[model samples]
Target: MPFRINSQLAQLIEQHYPAVKTAGFHLSPVAGLTGESWRVSMSSGEMLARFHSPDRQISGADRRREHSILRHIARHNLGPCVRLYSSPWLLVDWLDGAPLAEDAFAGAAQDVLTQSLVKLHHLPLTGYRLDLQQQFAHYWQHIDRRRLTPAWLRLHKKMMRCRPPAPLRLSLVHMDIHAGNVLETPHGLRLIDWEYAADGDIALELAAMVRSNGWNAVQQHALVQRYVDAGGYRDLVLLQQQVNRWLPWVDYLMLMWFEVRWQQTGELKYCEWAQPLRP
Candidate 1:
């Protein structure tokens, strides 16, 4: 189905760039799980427009916060430059790059990814803290408890028992780090989708990388070693422990997300994703 820009959005686009009224909007095929994006070809150049997902709040996403973080990161040339922001709509300078392939995690890409993350973690605090347990509970509230299997129930119990270490050192983390969100440009590897970025334990970021990338135990160790090599967190033993602690929480959050998405779209793929946890 062709995605047509609504009258309201079209008017907003015209208001910002009147030339768009003539050249019109060209929708990008790269639709995200939480937003519809487009590339508007103007007489001057190209601009990226995004319509944030209505279901964003269910996952505790704040577009304004994301915009603020993007602006901060753009200063360091890490993300796209923001041109305009209006409520759920955001327009930014279009980036010319390709999303990393699933198999692109090895070799130079892995090194670049590690260095990029280390750099991001070193950034000053953004005044946003991600409470994983709280987020889990929030998502759990929207899910039907009866839908969970004994295995999932056990996992949830285990996650409840685990906790972050004392006096946690928080850093700016891109919680949703994965191949899809990473773009390989001429400049370097740039991370997109700042909606889930916040101040959190660096180990949580490591755990997310492992889970989202489907890394094996060896691969996980290698990635962590690379991170450590790049002057990230010391204390390898404690770092591994922290990463382990976040694994269950990550899985639970994603499981709840899949359930909520299934409920919203009645999409069989979401149900299929939820089934493995359903015994």
Candidate 2:
């Protein structure tokens, strides 16, 4: 379908590439909950432009931080190349690949993903720490308490008391790393969507993978083993403990995110997805 370009986006494109002529514009079939994404084809090449939603569900995401992280990851040939970034709007080189299927993370694909995560964790910190408590509070404050069920409330309380393992080693983590965010490219797996990226507990990253992918115990074990095999972490017990601590918190965050999204879009799908978690 034809994509609509707003005046601001057109102006930004003009400012960046004054001489280039636009050949075509198409909206990507896959849309992000927090933004509208489009593929803009020009005489030079194809680029992906994302217009950030003003009422994005995740309140902790900072566009500047994401831009910085994207630039860093791009330097390592990890994610999309940032072409232009102006608050709430970003344009990156369009990557050609298919998003990983739910069952694709195994064997070689698993190794590639593990290596990528290890590489991502080792990147120089950007001095931003993801505070789960603070993020939870932000989302909770925005949501109407009446919308929360007893089970969710109890889980929230449990999450509040959960503590990270001592001597937490912070790493550059892609806070959202589900199958959808990973692309299977000719070279290897490329992780996209750095909006929630931050320097945080590495275990939280693992927990996010498990939570987002709905991996069973066997699958989760295989993933953890791959991470260990990649030299990402030692002490399986400790890693498991850390992941355990983060799992509930991740669920709570997701619940609140879905709740907020449902409210914003009046979409019953979001509400239905959240119902299973409620009391």
Candidate 3:
């Protein structure tokens, strides 16, 4: 669906970007998991503006960090160039390509995705460490207490006590990685949505990717070996162990995220998805 921007929204975009001749601009809505995104077409070029999620309490997103990360990565060609950024709104060059679909993401797609992620993982720290414990605490506090079953509380307590493997090394890790987030763009494979991106252990990112994609041991090992082969430093055994150790945390985080999203949108799908994930 196209985002028909009213005069108010049009003025807001124009206020931040006056260079685009008033001859006109258009907003076309783009579908995504979080945030309201619209592709803005102007005389200069196409840009995408993302409004922050309505309930930041649940998302635990820091737009300032996201904006900084985008600016930092775009220079390295790992992501899109930042067009403009202000509170609640981040505008960047519209990535012009389809997401790496499952069929297309195999073989060759895997190669480039691995290559790009290695480069991304090697970048300088974004000065923001991802405090999953702190974030989880925040979310758990917000979720309706009535819905917290004894089983769920038991699992949550266990998760809270479980300590993940220490960071072998920290880098600018793109916390969100998957086929959908990787665009097969004209330039190359570009990773979008840096909201959850932060400075963290690279293994955690890999673990999250593996868990999110439902990859088995063989496939997960393929990713680990791929990273190592792509010049990304990894202790073959240690990294594999770390990935396995982090899987429970990853799964729990995903479940909580879905629960929070379900609450935010009142969307049955999000709730339905969370059902199996619940305790």
Q: How far is candidate 1 from the true structure (C-alpha RMSD, Å)?
A: 2.9
Model 1's alpha-carbon lDDT is: 0.77
Instruction: Give each model a TM-score.
Output: 0.87, 0.88, 0.92
Ranking of all predicted structures according to lDDT, beginning with the best and ending with the worst: 3, 1, 2
lDDT of 3 by residue, 44-147 (tens): 78998877655753577777788898888877988888888876677889989888888766556888888888898888887999877777787786675667
Model 1: residues >4 Å from true position, as ranges?
A: 1-5, 19-29, 32-35, 149-168, 277-279
For model 2, the stretches where C-alpha displacement exceeds 4 angstroms are 1-5, 21-35, 57-59, 106-108, 154-158, 161-167
Error of 1 at 4 (Å): 7.8
User: lDDT winner among the candidates?
Assistant: 3
Task: Work out candidate 2's RMSD over C-alphas.
Answer: 2.9
| Tens digit per residue, CA lDDT, model 2, 1-279 | 123335556667777787654554433433642336767677778888876665653545666787888887777878999999987678888888998876676445778888999988888988877777778777777765678668778877877777744424689999888777889888777888888898888888888888877777787777777887888898787787788777777777777777777766778998888776565
lDDT-superior candidate, 1 or 2: 1
Q: Score each candidate by Cα lDDT.
A: 0.77, 0.76, 0.80
Instruction: Flag regions of model 3 displaced more than 4 Å.
Output: 1-8, 19-21, 32-35
